[model samples]
Target chain A: MNERDALRALAADLPHAGDDAAVVDDTVITTDMLHERTDFPPGTSRYTAGWRAVGASLSDVAAMGAAATAAVVAVYADADFDEADLDRFVAGAVDVCDAVDAAYVGGDLDTHAEFTTASTAIGTLTDAGPVTRSGAAPGDALCVTGEWGRSAAALRLFDRGRDDAAADADAIGTVDASNGAVERANELFRFTPRVADGLALAPHATAMMDSSDGLARSLHQLGEASEVGFELDRDTLPVHPAVEAVTDDPAERFELAAHFGEDFELVCTVPESAVDRVASDCPGTLVRVGSAVAAEDGITVDGDPLPDRGYTHGTE
Target chain B: MNERDALRALAADLPHAGDDAAVVDDTVITTDMLHERTDFPPGTSRYTAGWRAVGASLSDVAAMGAAATAAVVAVYADADFDEADLDRFVAGAVDVCDAVDAAYVGGDLDTHAEFTTASTAIGTLTDAGPVTRSGAAPGDALCVTGEWGRSAAALRLFDRGRDDAAADADAIGTVDASNGAVERANELFRFTPRVADGLALAPHATAMMDSSDGLARSLHQLGEASEVGFELDRDTLPVHPAVEAVTDDPAERFELAAHFGEDFELVCTVPESAVDRVASDCPGTLVRVGSAVAAEDGITVDGDPLPDRGYTHGTE
Candidate 1:
């Protein structure tokens, strides 16, 4: 069995085993580990690395609609690791915590053969309580926060020399920003967890999960947990303009939207009656993607089978 | 600056940033990272690795007299890491949690170049609020739960061909046990956290900290935090018999007792009036080794200067 399977088998008897974060009393706790080789690209900045690590964990808390309160970080680096890199990393972590209004609490540090980060985020539930992946019901409206495929497009842009096009297309609509689109996209690679959107949608969401593992995998996970399936409308997938600029074929861009992970967007199923209300209440754009169906129908997009090709750690 | 300095510099603005664990309401959260090259020695069992990683984090909770509720672990290993080792590791974690009356909640697992374990422990405070290191005052009777120097002696035994001798002296009173003394010492290598001792003393403890970083370093920390110094009686120091067997020099054995970390004992200060009551209430042997003094006096043992030579992360 893989790491996921091993942990699942071991914790099968525990409560809140498969949820985004374990809930004890009113607190929600989640942890994420980032390895230098797997999670960081060649040109990744230390600042981005720290933010991404902490952000990934906070995203899990956000996925549950919990208000993140604090974060604890553990960093392991080689003996000769640069001090400046560590400073930038710490700056990134502190800055992100400031952005979310959470405290950057103290954590442990050690030396290892390579750079690795493990961050844990602690959050508390609002009065609405948590929104779990198993709460979806048949006929619920499927929705996602903001656009997708920007991270994938950014990667493609980085592969080419079109830093200018990459920056312009992936722009969160900001001009004269110091960083290029590719850098911004990379910055948002595992972008903000939908903390605000989650809080707003918690009361309306029947089921919710972060699309860190791609829309397809997250949908599959929610379906399996909720004992339902999903049917998506290809035209409504909210592919980012950067994806269109990078890919020639519309189908490829849609596929990237469906399968590119680390968008850090929330994919939720809301009651059909509350769909418009949640969308209107969310801070960012909320796109209607599809609807939940009977389990026997299985997962599909425009009546075609959608593959679970999202990034799976260790396998990749 | 080291990891501690770096995090401190970054989180200077946050409340409770330097505590052993960050407190949120009634809960305590702390994290620890264990790297194979540094934390795990040759012949270390996967079971031991898992237990040590989880136990290390739990120790922080114990230092605060919290009731451990659950733990989340993040394991990063090479792609080709042995499956059996992983299973053993999980089993070890579960066993430790069971021992501590805590649930081994689920965690994340991924592949990396080397084996690294990062575990976060969640706990709830008892009726007594957290016993922080800064709570001590002048003239408090300084006490430590249980004996020390076993871990250092065990290492010496392991270094020599005297595993049997190492295990024998460090045995936790093998009244009706099957494992040999050496085996017992090995088992206690990453000893159990002093949870019960911490709880019993919390109500009366003026100040509390763990001996994970050795007695000398912990005393210095307590001194700095509480603005009080420590005067330890060398004769009163509860040096384990294993230390005596491992080293011939009296000064060397005392040094080991003071400087050997990872004993997982509690170093606490109690008011003179409550000293006897606290000692009697303890679950294990409680030794009165010293008294808290004015900060101007500084920390010393037998009126001699004490050195902070305990185990430190990133040093190995």
Candidate 2:
């Protein structure tokens, strides 16, 4: 079965299974699995992998509008895996946890044919309770945190580096150039999960979800869950500077900004009156991109239907 | 680096990283990773894998003398993995959580080259506070819950089944016989983690740990952590009925009982005065196998020094 089907089956057994994080009492918990082949591309550093893997689960905690507490990551690698790579991975995990004031508690280590990681993050619910995806109402302002398309830009740079290396097999002196591209890609790949933003918006956000699956897919998820539609202003969508560095085509830029995921930004809805208050309370920038509409109106971008297209884990 | 070295490095970064579960205020959380190659033998079922993987994490929570609240597992399997097998896996996970009164609050699924699982369990600390392996006194009673060597017997049965199948490749009629052995092995492999026993012993016990490693290794670990030694009575060690069914030799039985791991039993230290009270409070059989002694006296079983040996993840 595909992941969606498997998740559906799981939700039948667990009442809180479909949420970004399962809320048990006042604690929120979430787990994520990332495989080497699917998650890490060629020239990806162990540090980047560690950061991204843990950050993904932390993002789920953020989506729940909770205060991030702690995280653990299970690392599966070959028996003969390089020690330095492992050290770098742990260092990156620790750094990411430190970035959000959460502890990187210990996890398990096992030998496998490929490098894989499963991360679990725990957070405490704020007094406002969890801002679930099912609470958006008509007239609520739809907003997103930070810029988009950073991960898309990183992927483009990685592909360019690979192509350059393929074209010059004998050029040993070009190693530095390829390495530079990898460093830049890694920089873009690493993102801070918006835990503080989630906490700040907890009282104001009618509904909230993360854009790990891109803005369009997140909107679709929130709309379906809340039984509301959206009307967005495409001009208001914040495109990351990294996207312009990689592509100049307007269509490509729009595609990357709307559909390429891994931004780790919060997609939320706030009452129009609370927008100014939320903006001031939020630790980071918040861009108002749209407003929630009646369910029959359907989701749209500049009067056009917004197709539900984004990153989904491949089953084949 | 080996798992031990890797853990040591982690402990240096986080103070609570060395324990079986990290205690953050009232919460005790733990994660475990198990791979198909090392954890599952031939003819193993996905249901058993789910049970054992999640059980391992719950066992860590038990070691902390806490009340298990919930668990989540991340499953990584091939894209074309059997749907029924996945269903059985989820059923097994849910059943185990039900056994411990903990919620199986869903998990993540991803495609990978091998079937691997990483499970995290969260528990709430009791009024006695979180029990660590460092609180044993010299005169405390060294005890264990339930019998040992079930996993060892199951492994032997698995090997026997493999050998029988290899010898009778053309014997289609013997399929049921092989399957019966597999069923028996699976039964032996499935074990209930000692969460109840841990909670019951928390008020009276000084130190506690689960014997995922053999009794000998567990004692050594508790010894190192608590700065105490032990004198064990070999006759008092409770061996599982399955172990006797598989091995007739006395020495072999002893080896399996004392050295074979994955029993998921609690190894604990209670004050001598509280032993009777603990026995009455504990839900399962309580075997008083030894008594903690001063560190300089060293650990012995039946008047001989016990070896510091048990299962350690391979890093070859």
Candidate 3:
């Protein structure tokens, strides 16, 4: 079982669990962790790490269509963790909270074998209540905010140890360098959470969840939760331009579009009548990805079975 | 600068970065972290670790006189982290929340290089608002719930590698074992947060904070926040019997009483006239160890300077 499975099993005995965040009437509470080894690649600044950590959790709040109110972070670092880096980390955390219009309240710090950040974001739900992952109906139009495959392409660049070259390329405003792939990937690494988009589409959404896990995995989860399937249009999948710039394999880019996660984009199902409204209302470009189908139909892309290519923590 | 200093400095830049927890209107939010290397000693069961991690954060909510509604935990453990141990940890966390009349709503889990737990507790303020650490007035009676010197004494036994012997002693109800010190300390390590006592004292407390840091440090903090010093009566400090049993020297036991942290007991200031009422109303023994004094009076016990020997994270 994965971390999510273990959490589900443990949560079965508790009063609440399994949601993006635990909702207590009006409050939406969620947490996310970022470990240095798993999350930060070379050239990943403390500010980026801090922002990503806090933003990762806030993404859940946004997925719930809630307005974030405040956040508290718990940071564990090595004994030798630098004070300047710590300050930058906190600065990043504060900056992200400000971006979301939430207060960065107090948090705790401790020494550990390595650096780990666990952040909790608290938000208040609107009159529409929370937009859960289990509300999609058979006829609803499936959609996602923003493009895909950037984080996966960025990961490829990092794995090739070209992250520094990418940073240098961006610094010098040279996009056509030999290290252009890295530069393009780095831009994706700094993707922001689509909070405003989520808030905008929440009123019309039938179901919603962030594409933190790969889109394929998110679709599978949503299908399982709502007892429905999906028919995604491969031609309509909004693959990021950087994905093509980073790799020449059209099939590989499509796989990344389907399975690569950490996009922090809202994937929601809305009535067909409201699809255009959702697309127009959201801050980011809203792609008409697919439509929900009967559970027996299974999940598919362009009339073909969608492969299981999404990320699962503790599995990779 | 250390983690605390870093947090303090970062907090100075934010709108809400201080206080036991971030208070948003009537809600009280607090976070705390526990690491295996520094928090759990030898023979420390997963159950204890889970309970302590959740209890530590809840103690802060109680300090604020808030009614705890729910809690969320984030657990990071090695890839080889045992499934059964994880279950026990969750069970312990659930049990502690039950003890405090709060729900363990949900949490996140991930694989890490080592074991670390970061928990946040949510509570609602009472009619008394928050009993902060900055409300003490001169001439008020400074009191604490329960006894002290147990955790420090327990650490000594753990350092001696007699924790197992202590558990065995407890299992068989044998207090007079050769390693009696460990047994005594073990009992102390299993302490419950004084939630009831804190709730009872909130209405009357002029100022309050948990003695997670040694009593001396807590006093200095409360003094700094409230602009008042203290005059502690050495004879009145309710030093745990285990302290005397663990160490023969009176001065050494006294030092432990003054400087040993993680007691999870409320140290509060109440008007001198309400001292008896507080003592009679609290669930635990109300030890009148001192009285709030003018800022220049300085914090002292028996007219002698108390040594700064309490626990500080990232120190060792």
Candidate 4:
């Protein structure tokens, strides 16, 4: 069975299993695991890996519309792993936590054959209760924070770098060579989780979740949880400049922006009357992408069915 | 560098690093990572692996003298791992949480080359403040909850089982042929973390920590953290029956009980006036094996210096 099926079996025992983070009292907690083979690419730096891994869990906290409090990352690496890499990893982890005004609390470490990390983030509810994915209703405006496709663009660059290295040892030519594609890839990989925006949207958004699993899949998840469908305007979805540099085809850019995961942006449903207020109050970019509709209407983008596809772990 | 050295380096970035769990306001949180090669033996069942892995983090919560509220475990295993094993693992994880009155919240899963798990646990402080390791006083009694060397004995049994299997096909004789040694080993491996005892001792204990790294090492750690010395009475050390069954030599028994790790017992310091009260109040067996003394005195057992050795991850 795949991770989803395993999670379904576990859900019977976990009453608070569906949300991005488990809410206990006024606190939100979540965990995420990432491995070297599936997560980090050949040219990825240890710092970027640490930032991306810990940031993923922090994004879960943001999805709960809570104030990021603290995070811990348990590192598992080979016995002979370089000390510099470990230090760099911790430095990146600390910086990410500092960026979000959260503490980089300590965690455990163990020896393993492969490099792996598991991060857990804690957050606190603001004046408003948590904005769960189950709270959306028909007629709510669908919104996404910031642009997408940055990670997808980074992956494309990494693939090209690998191919170039294979062709010639020193021909490690960068994607968009003038811009230093390796540096750009790492920059794209490191994302600041939308914690401030989450807190700002808590008081206004009806339902919210992060688009770490691609916009299309996130919409499907929200639809399933909230029992509502969405009608997205293809023109309104913000595509990152990185995607444009990687591909000229509008369809390819749209696919990368909408279906490729790891955007780390908040996707929420807000009352149409409160949409303008939320946009103004948010600390980051918030764009109106669609409107929540009755479940019978079905989820669609430009009047066409949106494919349910995104990053998933294990074989399905 | 070893895990301890890495931790020392990281301590600079993490102000709240040295404790078993990082305390944020009234909450205590901690994470632990365990891999198959370094942690589990050849015959360890998936259920036991899950129980022991999650239990390690719960023990950290117990050491903080907090009420365990919830736990989450991220499982990373080969893609082709058995579904039945995954189900049993979750069942064990859920049951362990239930035993401690904590909710088994959800977690993430991913594919890895080897079986690995990372678990995080959350707990809340009681009416009394958190009992940290740095609070021990010179006159306090150094006590331990339950017995020691259960896990050590289990390890011995596992080693013998491996040897037996190699000796002759289908031989697999039990350690104590009549007692079903393999079954006993697994039972011994599954020790309940001292959560209840920790709570009971919290109101009275001056300092607290878990003895997962053996009693001798735990005393040294508490001494270092609290800046105190210990004078342990070797005769007073409570050795588990499992240890005695594994070895007939008194020296071997003492070595296993004092130096071997993974017992998951509470090593705490209580005031001289409250020792009797604490022993009676604790839900589990509480043994007064030593007393805190001036730092100049140094740590000793039976007038001899005790070696500070136990289960340490990575080479030290």
Candidate 5:
């Protein structure tokens, strides 16, 4: 099974797992993984493992209206687990932890045969009310903080083939995930999570979650979680310059912007009354992606249903 | 290199690794892998992956003087990740987790080309004090909790080896690790980390650790950490009934007892003044294994040189 199947399988077994993070009852949302590009092949400027693990988990916590606090980690490393790698991974985490004003606290490590990393992050909310996927009220305004498509671009530059044509095309066009089409793909991989944005909108937004799986998948998941459907205007959706210039296909460009996930951006539904409040309070621009409509549960573009392929994690 | 060599080499780099657990600054220590019967191939029965992973990580946590709080897991399986196997594994973990009282909160599952089980556990101490192996003061009473040599016997029986020995060996046997050996071994594999013991000893034991790498290697490590040496009396050690039944070869038996590691027991030292307190508080029986005597920087057995396999961790 790929990451998606793996997640679903685990979900099947764990009924209490919350949509935004791994919620086992109340008070925790976990997002832990060893991401690609950044951790290994040192000279490469990928995301660090510590950041990947903690940052991802941070997004999960933020999705649920919680303040970040502490974490513990276990790393099974090879003989090659040198100081430099740790300095990068842990140093990056330390920077983020400091930036967030949290503590590195405690964890453990041992040498295993392969590269294995396990981290359990814990935090507390002032109130224990879990902001689940089931909270969107019909007719709520669907707003997202920050732009999408950059992270997908960055992964391409780092892992996939990076051709200039793709980058150059996307540079002038709108909504191209094509490498050359998106000149700033590299910036996406280093995209800081929307924790600040999440915190600001937490109170006003009826329901929210970080868009790790692409825009469509995230929206679709929100719809599924809240049991409500929303309409996304293809024209009104905010597409990064990276999205337009980086790809050749206009429809795919839109899909990549919508369906391509790992954005770590927030998609939330706010009351019309709270919209201006959130836009004013949130650090980044709060773009109107769509509205939490009265429909059953699915997304529509130009009155037609959009196909979904928001990145699905697979077994490697 | 095999798992042992890999762990040894990795352990070598950790000059500041073990104080209480395998964490130094920010206090971090990590993983251990568990495979099923098919995984060991040559050795099956009376063991399960879930039990092994929990036990292994727990012991390491015990070494760190931290109580396990949560666990994150990554599982790699083929079609054989069956209901029965999963049920057994989950059940076993539930039993151990409840016994340990550590919550099984969150984890991820990824399918694999090979069958692999991995658990990343996080633990913490109430006080922020770090208990390192290097803290053993000369004249410290070298001590261990509970008995030894049960796991070896369990493994022998589980292996169902080619030797047409006269006994069921692990369960019935007359030497090395048998009876309590394999059972203890399985217990080590299935042992909940004695976090309570580690915590109790944290304030009093000058130098402390969970005995996973066996006694010899741990002794060397303790000496290395403390920058001192000691004498271990073979006769004074706490040998289990199964262990005594095994081999008459003191050196070989000791090798399996001390250097074979994975005993998951505790090897700690108390000051002469605090010895009584330690003896009374430990969850397992506290026995005088040796003493921090005057020596260059390694453990001695009855004043004679003892061969040490040390602690090895890694994939075979």
Candidate 6:
């Protein structure tokens, strides 16, 4: 079977009413997620690629409400892969681990016939209170650590071969390069959404997750786990400054940000009483963008169903 | 500016490392070592590949006198790779997690232009005391958990490319394609070094490591970490039945067992005082294979310096 079918088969055994595929060790613990085109690609910069490599695992820790502490990176370098390319890739890995305050612990490396990188990150979560996908409850307000949609924009830029849109200021220049495409791409790829906001809201939030997929997809996941629907205010959806500043069409930018993948930010649910406290704390904003509803309503945006459904790793 | 060179430059921040190296976490944690050519490959039976993937990671937890509690699998897949391979791989990983009693808490999967896989397994020390790579004092008696030569024999079979021999007994009988060479090649690829035995012995072993690289190379690592030299009794080596069955040259077979890569058993150093306990309680014999001596001698075999050096990743 192709990878998507395989993923669907495998997803049957994952944390959705399946066995909790988690290891509980004192020295190192790991949760493994397999992503294909859904996560990242070849020829991506050291930064985004590395972020995709590490941020996924770290988000697992954050979703579980644990402080990310360390990581071990394992990658499959192709036959024709350069030694330098491997080094840069690893450096990118180390950079992300450092960014998250995690160390690159021990790991094994080998050459494979295909180009794949799998990372296992170990973190110190001794104080965590067992955050999981199964913890969200009804009546909790749906919130996210930061805005979304930049990664998709970046992917579009990448698709069009807009290589020079590395920085935001020049991003506009590159946006003008592909008829304003770079502006769309630059804003998405560069966002690191770890949600220092989540930690502040942790005491108040019922359940949380990092939105690597689109906001709709993540909300759906939350709904599936919590057995509740969600209603989001389309107007309340926070848009990034660069996304708005670079692109004239606010609605287009907002739409992209809402459903774009790879933001790596937290989609959390808190008690309505604690929203003010969450808003007051956190380096990233704690915006109350939605509220949990009955499952029948499904998840909606501005009283209408979310279109384009969120990005799916294999099939979509 | 190859991958390795860039890695070294970027990892200039790492403390006291070698080129293409593995690091000790410096905590009371355990890790395992595996590579595509050795523990993971398409050559092993389809049923076992996924389990073996987890087994590769679990081997480390077994060595640390710890329980295989959680695992992080880092994978590098080629652009042309299929997701089915990943499914089988994850299947193996999940099976291994179950085997080790650890959860697969978190991992990262990225696509490279090349193929590679790395797994970092985190294990918890069973008791309050933690085992480390150090602690082998002079006069410590050397011990191993199980026989080593099977993987080497398997390697021989695989290298030969015999179809029937490559297939297990049932397969050989049915698919009688006499892949003598393939069978030989498959032999080493399919072996899972004894993790349970290693975990059982972790408490008493002064210094412990899996024979991941090979017996001789592992000894060198233990010696380096423990600041001690070793003397092995070549005649006392545990030659597997298969190696004896497959190879004509006794010395060569013994050498392969001693030096062949992918023998996942643990070769450990136990204080002379605990030698009896090791022998009685552990599955493998306490052959009193060697002694930890002053650094002057350095990793000796049969009371002499090693003739052929041990395995080093990316280098001969």
lDDT of 3 by residue, A61-124 (tens): 9999998887888887777777787788888888888888887886877877767889998888
On TM-score, the leading prediction is 2
**TM-scores, each model vs. reference:** 0.90, 0.96, 0.90, 0.95, 0.78, 0.81
- Stretches off by above 4 angstroms in model 6 are A1-5, A11-43, A78-91, A112-115, A124-128, A135-138, A156-195, A314-316, B1-12, B15-43, B72-95, B104-117, B126-130, B158-196, B308-316
Q: Tell me the TM-score of model 4.
A: 0.95
Instruction: List ranges where model 4 is wrong by over 4 Å.
Output: A163-168, A171-179, A314-316, B163-179
Clashing pairs in 4: none
Error of 2 at A125 (Å): 0.3
Ranking by TM-score: 2, 4, 3, 1, 6, 5
Give per-residue CA lDDT, model 2, range A183-246, as digits (tens). Answer: 8988998999999999999999999999988899999999999999999899999999999999
CA lDDT of each prediction against the hidden true structure: 0.80, 0.87, 0.80, 0.86, 0.61, 0.61
Which residue pairs in model 1 clash with each other? Answer: A167-A181, B167-B181, B167-B182
Q: When superposed on Cα atoms, how far off is each prediction in RMSD?
A: 5.5, 2.2, 4.3, 2.7, 6.7, 5.6
In candidate 5, stretches whose alpha carbon ends up further than 4 angstroms from where it belongs are: A1-31, A34-54, A69-130, A155-186, A202-205, A294-297, A306-308, B1-47, B127-130, B161-188, B241-248, B294-297, B305-308
Off by over 4 Å in 1: A1-3, A7-12, A161-182, B1-4, B160-182
Residue A288 error, candidate 1, Å: 2.1
Which model scores highest in DockQ? 2
Better of 2 and 3 by lDDT: 2
Interface RMSD of 4: 1.6
DockQ of each: 0.52, 0.69, 0.61, 0.65, 0.23, 0.32
Runs of candidate 3 exceeding 4 Å displacement = A157-187, B156-187
TM-score of chain A of each: 0.90, 0.96, 0.90, 0.95, 0.80, 0.79
Fnat for candidate 4 (0 to 1): 0.65
The deviation in Å at residue B178 for candidate 2 is 7.7
How do the residues A192-306 of candidate 5 rate in per-residue lDDT, one tens digit apiece?
A: 6566676677677788888877778777788877888888888877777766656778876777678777777788898888888889887778888788876555678767886
* TM-score winner between candidates 3 and 4: 4
Best by lDDT: 2
